[model samples]
Target: MMNYERLQSNINAYKKTGEILEAARFLIHQFNLDDENFAGFGFREELEKESILLTANGEIGEMQHVMIPKNIFDFDLTLVLNMLAHEMLHVRQKSPRMMILDKNEREWQAYYEMLFHTNFPQIPELSDYYKNFFGEKALIYYSRMGEGSELQLKYLEQKLEVEKFLQDIKNKTI
Candidate 1:
């Protein structure tokens, strides 16, 4: 179960920073990500464009590093959560050690998982954007991952269970 008290504490801690942190926390729990394995260090504001990158050098999915500009923090909390979840999915795939796969492939997998798993209803909008830019083939690939295979269904069912649990907690709070 997710530690709601701890999540609430973290939310309070990042109150001055903005709601992005809280959204990230919700995603962390929703995905069952281990905070110990993933690190959110070096969140200092940058003047340049806001971006999040996954570094596979030292910790091969053991640590998550995020960089966000101060200006864009409040503009889009969902975008920030999506970026954080995207990187965390890379961490889940253990992509850092796999040298044969290119960054694009890794990103595709992360994006696919995020779109399929997250409860956030804005996924269609995000998927449309990706399909527009990266071509419909990628989106088609993601949607087709379950045509004849039971594995994708099982995975999605588990994701739905977790998401439902998180939603239950959110509802109780309300």
Candidate 2:
């Protein structure tokens, strides 16, 4: 197992300049997440051509590189925390096949968790999007541990189909 003390020390060094990294550690502990293969947390000034606001790569249960685009720091703390929570949810999704769910399903689950459960202030647009898609009661029903999970998966599939249709139309219009 990795030495958490050393990790905390490293994260402490960033407290002065890298609030995001410190927040990452805080979220990890808050969520009681497993980050055994989590390699390191930092920011990149220059990102790849197709990079996301936050990015990670590498095999499951092995060293994984997780980073944030430096520009993301310019955004609101809630947005930053939301983004970090979304990515950390991915860390919890490890399975024998690397990921138990498809991309869209994983994203849906992550968004639902971040928006409804993380206790972080949500971006209104995102919360509205979820509400529009799943409605408030349905979101609450699906957010629970063992309740409505199967139905949530069913709803997720239908939501993905609708999203794909919308995306296709947008592409056509463009």
Q: Pick by lDDT: which candidate is best?
A: 2
Model 1 RMSD to the real structure?
10.0
lDDT of 1 by residue, 1-174 (tens): 345466445545565667654545555666455344455533444555544333322245445454434443443444444555565655555534543234444555555545454433333234334323333433444346555455445346543543454455456657
Off by over 4 Å in 1: 1-27, 44-62, 95-101, 118-174
Please report, as a residue range, the 10-residue window in candidate 2 with the lowest summed lDDT: 119-128
Q: How many backbone clashes are present in model 2?
A: 0
Return the top candidate by TM-score. 2
User: Clash number for every model?
Assistant: 0, 0
Q: By TM-score, how accurate is candidate 1? A: 0.44
**Candidate 2 residue lDDT tens string, 1-174:** 235465445455555476766656664565455366576677766565433467655565455566777555454444555567666666655443356445545555665655355433332224343333433323444445244466566766544544554455456656
Provide the TM-score for each candidate, comma-separated. Answer: 0.44, 0.49
* lDDT of the candidates, in the order given: 0.47, 0.53
